[model samples]
Target: MTKIPTALLLTCDAQLVEIDLPFGHDCASSAERRAVLRAALRCDRFDVVALTRQWDMWIDDEGLYNHPVNPAATALAQRFGFTHQPYHGPVLLTGGPDAQGNTLPLLRHQVIGLFLTLQDL
Candidate 1:
């Protein structure tokens, strides 16, 4: 048995909100991911969103960070056009093109990390 890569969603104050370790072909859609963020922003319990897999961390930094957007995430952001400013931040999407031109997202057991800052909202 292999371990699934863990993804942690942390608030600006560094509170853990969600931890996702998706299973085979069960990656969350862009919309679903956005919804989680939206709900968090609305709660006011969190101001910053930080998603990390292992050592890779994506921080919106109150919309200050210019983190490179993931190609597949960019497409989903374009499609939804969420009004929230942080939604303009990078998202988590599946089926990204690989180096060999294979349309695969991350490894099945790999986690997708996404981040947004509610201060921009």
Candidate 2:
């Protein structure tokens, strides 16, 4: 079967994870969640394209540095190893199939951003 990369929505609570990570469950504590986050980010089993909101508010594409990035988000990105932002922002998160029909990395970092997006959503 063709695998569609799953996006791990990073959040501080439980919203709707069954839609993506069926094998996962609600975390009991912040420490537990962080542990899971670290493992997911560094898992060698597959690539994880991290995602998160860098800025508190939307900004122009060129204005990435013009505004202050969320310190928490920045720390999370750095903690996960996202050398730079990869997904489009200002309200745009697009995706498509891989050439090999292989699923993309379950978004662990953007999954980081993703976790937030799902939280906000």
For candidate 1, the lDDT comes to: 0.35
lDDT of 2 by residue, 71-107 (tens): 3334444455654663221221212224543223344
Candidate 2 matches the true fold with a TM-score of: 0.24
TM-score of each: 0.27, 0.24
> Cα-based RMSD of the predictions, in order?
12.0, 15.5
Question: lDDT for each of the candidates?
Answer: 0.35, 0.34
List the candidate 1 regions with Cα displacement exceeding 4 Å.
1-6, 21-28, 41-121
- Looking at model 1, the pairs that clash are none
Can you give the lDDT of residue 90 in candidate 1? 39
**Which regions of candidate 2 deviate over 4 angstroms?**
1-60, 83-121
- Tens digits of per-residue lDDT for model 1, 45-71: 223222222122333434334333333
Candidate 1: deviation at residue 12, Å? 2.9
